[model samples]
Target: MELHALLSYTFFLLFLFVIAGETVWANEEDRKVANGGFRPTKLFVFGDSYSDTGNNPKSLASSWKTPYGVTFPGKPAGRYSDGRILTDYVARFMGIKSPLPYQWKKYGENKLQYGINFACGGTGVFDTGNMQPNMSTQIGFLEGLIKQTVYTKRDLDSSLALVTVSGNDYGAYTASGGPEQGLPSFISRVVNQMGINLKRIHDMGVRKVVVTALQPVGCLPKQTIFSSYQQCNETDNSAATLHNQLLQQAVTTLNNSTKGSSFLVLDLFSSFNTVLKNKGDFTGSLKFDTPLKPCCVGKKGDANCGSLDENGKALYTVCNEPGSTFFWDSLHPSEAGWRAVYLTLRSSLNQIYN
Candidate 1:
């Protein structure tokens, strides 16, 4: 009878242990799936303000102003949005905190476990409006680090890269008085060079490289302001359509040429348009009631979202809640906008998994 009792108690303990183990296993599988696969150990970012996370200096760039990081860190965080930007979400998808910016490398030199962010605001694939390093120079920064043995070949093996060449180049072209007739040809040049940059990153041993399609420029508040921010100019959207079409073809050709077509495209064009129009085939609630209007606006035509008066007072007006608004400024999306955009890219992001 004593032995029977002991055996019964032992079996009950074993049952409990089995249940606990199963629970842990299930949780891990859920985590892996949520992360889209094996979580990448590192992430590298490149391109314009959409991906830039404090890479630009406060002395030059406007990203480090008030109301930018108000929604996230409760202070200015050098991001273009009211909080985190697309790169932050991409890093989060990798199950890692946003990598430190390239400009502040020395501050946390020992914390390269995740990766580095070399993107700068207002920069583009080729030299654009900003004086900051161009896309090639940004890649050069990574190469220099690798050459210095900061990131080993093994590290690059498990790394992921996000490249966001937003419409800064187009803005540059337009600002420089490049003819509207020449726009299509110039877009081809930009995309062709972007394709080369993508291939180069892949060749450098990155496991995956995801590049974003340019969002609808004409739909931005800056463009729609003329219509009292009520409508998007069809002509501008048509130009965006042309860009996306070429980008899709370029990506398809790139994949066809590469073995795994290791380069992937993030369809921001469709996502932005969907959110702007409040209609999409996605599952999430992309119901933006006022997508054309920004959360913050400049008092004067020359001022911007976080602009300041000479008296040091804010020269811009902020919305009651930034999350409710789409654009943080004339160009970048609000943090909430980025969150919705991330959801829209869910189907494409699944390709990141092993």
Candidate 2:
């Protein structure tokens, strides 16, 4: 082989080695977490699809279909990704198994040690087009448990709460023919309601609450499809900026009013954009071949993430390797993408429990 081809072959070999070894390295990280003596022993989760772990009804949700959980656990586990969603990793960081999904929590009474996940996919801060419970209702589930004394005052004092609201309300707004001119006002309303939700949860006695800033909705494959997934829409990103700005103010005010630093905002927009700009720089162990394109896509533009055919065959095409893709579908990230973003948010996660 020529000199350049020889180097290309060498890099190819190393990439394969990393691919083979990545699973073992991930397992080792989990084992270390098991013995790491983390402070928070429990985690309570709320909000929409990003943090939802099987809370959406499997029979009606596409997330329970094939290939959704093809990576982690080797089967569909109702997470909105190929493998673990944000809930799983956040729980793992705190040295606990992910809390049971709200729809199934009652069945596993003994599994509430890590707190419960009340998040439902495709739902939002307010009631969206779907019938799934909104943010306040999600919190109501936790409050009901508290009222029944399922979690004593000590559990509430020792627990951490995670809140995620990924742009589903805006999506619903557009879908419902709500005009573009009205978006800013609607975003403000969303944040105000979210602030109320945060305060209500805090009042209910959760020790610490973490609210995630909106992810760059423009950067998602749904919006990127207009650019062939090659470029992001800056106008949409600007909207996200405004949303985060107001959210930061709200969170700051909440923390100032509460005892200690009771509220923190996870800067998902900044960290997600950073990951796109400098892929895998923190770990240097994995590389995404196409950061914008999804790992799984329908043959046509209209199909959902894990769509299937009448014959039970896959109607969508999957990339050769999901572990190298940042997105799994039009809306959600692959397991690898969440892992990368978690690594970027390591400092923020540390700030919450410590």
Candidate with best TM-score: 2
Write down the TM-score of every candidate.
Answer: 0.87, 0.88
Model 1: residues with Cα > 4 Å off, grouped in runs: 1-39, 107-110, 279-287
Write candidate 1's Cα lDDT for 1-354 as tens digits. 001111111111111111101121112211233222334678999988898888889987777888888886778878898887898777655556678888987634457777999999988888885688999999989989999989889889888999988788888899999999999999899888888888888888887888888787888888899998898878887887887788778878878887764777888888887776673225545445677888889988689887888799998999888887778888888988987787767656656664
Candidate 2 regions with alpha-carbon error over 4 angstroms: 1-38, 107-109
User: Per-residue lDDT for 286-316 in model 2, tens only?
Assistant: 6776788898888875877678778887788
**Among all windows of ten consecutive residues in candidate 1, which has the lowest summed lDDT?**
1-10
- The C-alpha local distance difference test score for the whole of candidate 1 amounts to 0.77
Which residue pairs collide in model 1, if any? none
Superposition TM-score, candidate 2 onto the true structure: 0.88
